[model samples]
Every structure is written in structure tokens, then in C-alpha cells.
Target: MFNPSPKQFKFIKALLFVLALLPAVRLLVFGFTDRLGANPIEFITRSSGDWTLYFLCITLVVTPLRRFTNWNWLIKLRRMIGLFAFFYGSLHFTTFLWFDHFFDIAEMLKDVVKRPFITVGFIAFVMLLPLALTSTNGMIRRLGGKRWQWLHRSVYAVAMLGILHFWWMRAGKHNFEKPILFGTIVAALLLIRVYFAWRNRGDGAAKSRTAVQKRQVTPTLT
Candidate 1:
């Protein structure tokens, strides 16, 4: 019932687009100016990848937010947010492949097999590719609503894999703080979804009971 004006929708899109670009802009400036401290490549790659996971988590939160807030307009931004997540994620993957591996296919393959963190991260990126490819309106129509919904549920798995990747990557340095924070945010978002789902089921049951009671109480005309 709460529909946003066309202007409001456009503004929202623009704002999110700008916000999504800010990180990349910062990274580019840092790279060009030689501003990355210590390990520049690692800093850029991790920062980009972290933002990608952040966006992915935020995109996942949109559904539950819409339902809980009853602000249906939020649905309009989910696709945009999701695609941005993929964009950042692609950049993250590319940075690692190009900067770290230097396009060495053999070394990259060996690293994936040897490092668990890389393995999970690679798999998460692979999962995101199909989702990004199908983000268009045409793909939605072709896949149909139900099938598309099913396919996109892969984001849940992607999120878990991403967190695991982050966690394991940090484990090497014995720095659990950042990964724990990310895991906490993701877990909180997921718990919100679970709570709302249970609440909706209860509301549905109550509505059904009320309808049945009303039917029983009504007198037949004949």
C-alpha cells in the first residue's frame, strides 16, 4: 500500500548507485596515487571483497526489512543492491587474479586447491556469476517468478561461504575480530528473517481462525 513516487524511486536508485561507487573510487585513487599502506594489493583486494560481502548481506536484509516495515517500496532497490554486490564481488575476484596471481592459471588453480580460504572464496564468486547474469528483467520473465526465486536462494549459501572464506583468511593471522564482526552482522540479519517468518505464520493461522469463526457464526439465508 505504501508506494513510492517515481521521483522518489529514481532518487533512491541514484543514491545507492553513488554509495556503491564510492568504495571503488577510493580504491582507484589509492592505486593511482600509491597510497595503499604496507601491502597495497592486499589492502585493496580485501577492502573490495569486504564491501562486496557487505552489500550482499544488505541486499539479503532488504526482503525482511520490507516485510517488517511494510515499506513495499524497498523491493525496488533489492535488484540494484544485489547487482552492486556482484559488481564489487567481480572486482574483488579480478583484483586477486590479476594482482596476486598475475593471470597465472596454473598457480591460481594450485592456490585454490591448496588454500581452503581461496577455495571457498572462489566458489562463492562462481555462485554469484549466474545470479548476476540473471538479474535483468528479461531473465526474470524467462525464468518465471517461482524458478527465479528458487535460483536466487543460492545467495544464502553464497553468504555462508563468504563468511567462511573471510573467517579462514583471518585465521592465518590469528585475527578473529573482523571476521567475527561480519559473522555477527550476518547472523543477526538471518535471525531477523527467521523471527519474521515465524511471526507471519502465526498471523496467517490467526486470520484463518477468525475466518472460520465468522463463517460458523453466520446464519444461513436459506
Candidate 2:
């Protein structure tokens, strides 16, 4: 209903691209202005991680929004929004590696093993890596539609892992509010997809039964 022309769609996409980067730009501005507060590294880490989760939520919402609203153009925007999720996730990871461990792989590995939250976050990031790498059109062609779709479905797991990582991280400090809210949103989004899938499967089975009944009736009538 609110469809845009090709040129307008491109402009809208470009605008979304700029808007996605605003969080990162804000972080840089804050750093330069010394507004990151007493614990700058921790502040940067938390802020970037929060934005990563926010983008993930937004990316997950796109499909459901498109289905309910019939905005087919939203699919075109999904790739960019998903990539932004990876971007913020990478930034969050970089903050840990650069500021927290100073690029010490051994120490990072040790911490990843030692901390449950870090382990979950590490696995989530590792899973996100392949998704980002195979997001190109060429890769999609190479992987084939079914396989590519199967691979991308892992985003559901990534979303769950992200929530678990955040929950565990906050467990120590007893800060459960934000994590609970995010987890609920992610859970609801996943459930919507699951419900549609289940309903479609039922519909397919019902149609098969009707076809069988029609065949039997035709033979008896004959």
C-alpha cells in the first residue's frame, strides 16, 4: 500500500544505512568529548553490546513486520539491518579484545573458557561470522536456496544465544530488567515464526488429505 518507486526505495535504503551507523558515531563523539564517564572502557563495551542487541531485535522484527503489513520492500532492507547487527556485534567484541585484553588471544581464550557469559557471547559471535560472510548474492547462489535458507535460520539461535549471554552477564550484578525485556521480545519474535511454520505445515497436510479423498471419490463414482 505504501510502496515506493525504485528511486525512492534506494533513497530510503541509503537513509536507513546512515541511521544504523548513528550509534557507532555517537560512541565516537562521546569518547572524544570525555563523556563516557569514569569507566570509559566498560561504558563503551556496554553501549556497543546494547546496540548490537537492539539491531538484532530490529532485524528479527523485519520479517514479521513485512508479513503483517505486506511491505515487500522490507525484505530488501533486512540485509542491511542484519549486517548492522553484525557490525555492532563486532564493535562490541573489538572493545573487549582491544580495551579489555589488548588483543591477547591467549588471555581472551582463557577468559572465554573461564566465564560462562563470555563463552556464550563468544559462540554467538562465532556463529554470526559465517552468516555475515555468506550474506552476499554470490554466496547465496553458491549455497543454493534451500541450503542458504537453512544456514540463515541459525540467526534464531544467535538471537537466543545473545539473550542468554546478556542474562548471564547481568546475573552477577543482579541487573535483570533489561535482559528480561530483550529476552521476551526475542522469544515473541521467534514464536511468531514458529506459529506460521506450524500453521503452514497443517495446511499442506490438509490439502494432501483432500486430494486423496477426491481421488477415492472419483474412482467410486466411476
Report model 2's TM-score to 2 decimal places: 0.91
Task: Report the lDDT tens digits of candidate 2 across residue range 99-190.
Answer: 88999999999999999899999999999999999888777778765577778889889988998999998998999999999999999999
Best by TM-score: 2
Query: What's the C-alpha lDDT at position 170 in model 1?
Result: 82
Candidate models: Cα lDDT each = 0.82, 0.86
lDDT tens readout by residue for model 1, 1-222: 767688877887899889888999999899899898889988988888899888988988887777678776777788888888899999999888898889998999899999899999999999999999987777777876657777887988899899999999888799999788878877888888668556655777888566445323221100
Q: What TM-score goes with each of the models?
A: 0.86, 0.91
* Residue range with the least summed lDDT across 10 consecutive positions in model 2: 213-222
Highest lDDT model number: 2
How many residue pairs clash in all the candidates, one count each?
Answer: 0, 0
lDDT measured at residue 19 in model 1 versus the true structure, 0 to 100: 88
